[model samples]
Target: MNISYKWLKEYVDFELSPQEVCEALTSEGLEVGSLEEHQAIKGGLRGLVIGKVETCEAHPNSDHLHVCTVDLGQGELQQIVCGAPNVAAGQKVVVATVGCKLYDGDKEFVIKKSKLRGVESNGMICAEDEIGVGTDHSGIIVLPESAKVGMPAAEYYHVESDYLIEVDITPNRSDACSHYGVARDLYAWLVRHGMKTSLHRPGCEAFKVDNHDLDIAVEVEDNKKCPRYCAVTLKGCEVKESPAWLQERLQIIGLRPINNIVDITNYIMFAYGQPLHCFDADMIKGNKVIVKSLPDGTPFVTLDGVEHKLSHEDIVICNEEEPMCIAGVFGGKGSGTYENTTNVLFESAYFNPTSIRKSARRHGLNTDASFRFERGIDPNGQIYALKQAAILARELAGGTVSMEIK
Candidate 1:
């Protein structure tokens, strides 16, 4: 498990350095294996700024390259030769100025004055991948007109850094799997050692139900296997990219950011140690969810596009028509949220650890959610995490929260 040193401080107010934090956690049984500082964007996007392309003309010597004059808000126009097929004038974009450093994984390269195809180039127009934010090399990232020219790209994008502490967790210590969980232990230790620190958490008092516009009924076939289940429906949500802060939080902990709907679920899971799933409500045939086991040799496709045969004891989460997820383990391919997904059915459930472990091993699969579920997470936190996710979805995805928690 990876814990962010800065994120951990958000909960426990300790005056410990990074090395001291590892020592403290090691003494508390959450042995820190390694500590490394992580930058959300390599080099923190220093020396990069927003620039407006003033003029774009084809390079005289190159067929594909274009020579452009860009306004960096520095009073003078910079002449740059860009190779992107989509480069055009009058567009606001990211500019890596001369002497700026960019990264391709661990490798680093510096931007300097150079000649490309006999045209003098001063800087570079950046693609999403070039800035370490995303993977889109087809074209440069275009900014909205509201973006301020000459603004530092780091400030514009709110780039930040944090320390990642990789901890080795034992199967019995399931409670320490999340950031809050680890903070709780640290808080207790601090109190015991006469430190005047307190534990703080992100408040969920803001969670409100706007209207019962959508309803999803849930039925559990076996209560013993699933002791608790909580769900909420969100309507009119725009599934798009998550905010920069959210993406940074997940990235520091080594999780790739998906869309907003899926990212919020992942954020909540790591924050609270509760695994949540989101399904495209439009794809659900009956607006109902049923938790039950399918027959032996039942074939199901997961999000990874792999088909797995199921045993009779495997618990499945199904809509009125068919199984949508391999309950607590992995989600189905078509039933999950997509780019056009507007309505979502978010679920939080507590499954039997032994059952989840058996099913996960049977299919030769181990997911983040299943890792937590198989080790026995807090059953009581399901509704709390569900409410937190709903609150985030409504705020970040522009959705209306459902009144009923099925």
Candidate 2:
């Protein structure tokens, strides 16, 4: 469980630095495994922008090089020999002036007045990865056309450093894997130490649910395998990339952004200690959802694009025709939601811990959901979690609740 400094600040008010917070957590019971500093590579590289491309001529010495004159926002023009093919006139780009530290591929170098290919080059143009935004170094970073000629790139990018505290949680402390769980512990500690503890959770009252012709039919063939199941169907969802803030939050937790619909489910799971799943309604074949033990010699493909063979003891989520997902394990790729999906069936349920453990071990796959279920989270809170996810999905993805499964 890696807790970021920015994330921890949202739950409690403390004047301690990240290192101090790690020490506090370690002294309390949650052991800190490691500490990582999140720093940008280009130190002191700011306020330099592209003025104008004076002349771009093919290099006389090298075949792939282009000798050009770039204005450094100041009146003087600096000649730079660059090998990037995308160099053009009137483009706003980063320029590493003298005395600035530049990092490229694990090697850090200080910019100085130097000559390249017999041309006096004062600085070098930068890419996105060079400035530490992303890992794309295929070409020079092309800024937005509206970017000012002499503006600080850091200010425009809103780059901030953070620290990641890797937490080693014991088996009994499975609840601490989520942000809300950690917040609970921190809240207890803060109240005990006379510190401020007031964290706002998203309200779920404005959401409305109606019973209509559309209804989710769930049949658990083996009650011993699945203890509880809760599901909701949402309509009018627009699946797309998540917002930057949401993406950053997930990245802080070491998860890459997928989409708004999927990220909301994942975010809710991390925030409230419940695992949720969103299924494509249009691809569900029939309106029925069945939770039961797999038949003998059944096969399915999970979300990770891997084929899995299911035994009779394994539990699965099936539609009228075939299995759509492995219950408490993974969703199948065939019935998954895509960019074009408009309707979705969200599931937040509790499975028998022993059954989930056996299925995970048999399939040789241990997912986050399986890990939590195997360790025993709150089993009776699936309905509340379903309502929470439904409200968030409606709020973020512009969806309507059609029906709910209980």
Candidate 3:
């Protein structure tokens, strides 16, 4: 279990540095594996700014190069030859001046005052990956149009000091797999050390099933195989990119942010110790959902674009039309939520561990949801978890309360 220091701070207020927190957690029986600091390339790349693009004439000697006079905000213009097609006047960009060391890939390059096409060039502009935010480097980063001429880009970008701490949690400590659980442990540590602990529960209440529009009808075809099941339906949702705070929270935990709808489900699962799934209500072929054993040789495609064959013993989720998702394992491609989806049907149910494990092993699809269901989570928290997802969805995605099943 990887616990990001940034995410861990939300649950508890501790004065300890990230390294100190890791050491403290490790001393209290939780194994802190390693801490990784993601830093940007280019030393002395601190305060340079894109003052102005004085001249952007095509390089006389090179076809793809543009020689421009860039204002470094220190009252003097610097000449640099840039290859990016988007370089323009008044665009704020990073300037790695001469004598600066930069990390490209596995090696480092020292920037030196050089001549390009007979023009004395001083520095180079940077991309996202070149500055270590992400792997995207298709184009030069255009600073926010409002960025001041001489302001430090690092301060504006907040890339100064962030670290990721890897946590090794034992099987019995499944609760620690979540941010709340880790915070619980940290709270205990704070109390033990006579320090202040201020962890509070979310103000939003658990979702109630009786107050929605659409009714959720769940047919547990084999109760012996799937011991418990719960579902909720939400209407009028807007599926879009998650808020920066939510995306950063997930990114800190090593999860790539998909969208607000999906991020809410994942956030609820990590926060309340229950796994939840959200289906685009309109994408479901039928109004009803059936959870049952798969028939012999039923074929399905999961969300990851992988095809899987199901046997009789495997459990799956189906509508009147076809098997839409492999229950407790993975969602099928045909019935997934997309950018235009509005209504959503969220699922938070308990399955027999053996049943899920068998189906996962058969399909060779072991995922976070499967791993949690296989090891067993708090079954009674099904409805509670579902409600949490609904609240987040409604809050983040602008959805209406529709229906729920307790």
Candidate 4:
């Protein structure tokens, strides 16, 4: 599990540095396997900053290239050559000047003064995928106008200098799979050891349900396999990119932020140690969910577009007509929330760890949700986790909340 140093601060305001925190975590039995600093990778990323395009004109020598003057707030404008189609004047973009080290996903290189197509190129422009911050390479990264010029891109984005701490969780210690769980342990250790620290301790957070007059229908055919199942109905939910804070939190922890609806479920999983799944309300047949074991040779496709055949030993989350989820494993492809998703059925459940482990290996699907389910989770926390995810869904995606599980 990779835990972000900055993210742990949200739960406990620890005054220790990131390295110190890693040491403290080890003492708490959350043994750290390896600690990596983002900026410390391959020396560092210096001279990377938010720059405003001052002027841009088509290159007389190259059709695809443009010459521009960028204002990096260094008291003088710098000349640069860019080939991104979306590069334009008055836009704030990422600038990697001479002496800066950059990674292009395939190789690491140093930015130096160079000439391209007869133009004196002093630096290089950046795209999201170019530096591996995201998968979008449609054009150069355009920062918001509120982005301050001359600010280091690392400081501006709050990443590029973060730390990634890798830890090993024993099968018996499934609770430490989440950052919150690890921090919770650390806090307890500090208190038991009588260590004094300036960090503000964030106690347990309560989930409140406002709208309760909802009609959500679900049935569990095999209670022995699935211990607890909880869900919340979100009406009129809009799917869109998550807010900057949410996206940054996920990205820093090596998770690709999808849409707001899906990100909320992922956030809850990492924060509360419960894996939640989001199903498009319309895709669920009869607006009902059923948890059961299927017969042998039952075919299904996962959200990642992979097909699998299930046996009687496998548990599934199905609607009245078809499988909506593979129980605690991967979810069905068609039932996932997407850009067109309006109504969402958010689900959080605890399954028999042994059953989930067996099914996961048989189906050859190893996912984050499955990893947690196979190790066990706090079944009693299902309702709290579901309602918390719903609140975030309503706030981030503009939805109406309705508690679905009793």
User: Who wins the lDDT comparison?
Assistant: 1
**What is the Å distance of residue 24 in model 1 from its true position?**
0.3
Model 1, 112: alpha-carbon shift in Å? 9.8
Off by over 4 Å in 3: 39-97, 101-111, 114-151, 205-212, 221-227, 295-299, 304-312
Error of 2 at 12 (Å): 3.4
Each candidate structure's TM-score, on Cα atoms with residue i matched to residue i, is 0.76, 0.76, 0.75, 0.74
Query: What's the C-alpha lDDT at position 113 in model 3?
Result: 81
Candidate 2 ranges beyond 4 A from true positions: 39-97, 103-109, 115-157, 210-214
For model 1, residues 250-301, the per-residue Cα lDDT tens digits are 9889899999999999998888899999999889778888999999998999
Please report the TM-score between candidate 4 and the true structure.
0.74
Model 4 segments beyond 4 Å from truth? 39-45, 48-160, 197-214
Cα lDDT, model 2, residue 332:
92
Which digits, one per residue and each the tens of the lDDT, describe model 4 over residues 130-226? Answer: 6656789889999899999999877776554678888888898898888778888777767777776433433325345557545578888999998
Candidate 2 residues 206-241, lDDT tens each? 667754435667777787877887788888889988
Each model's lDDT comes to: 0.91, 0.77, 0.77, 0.82
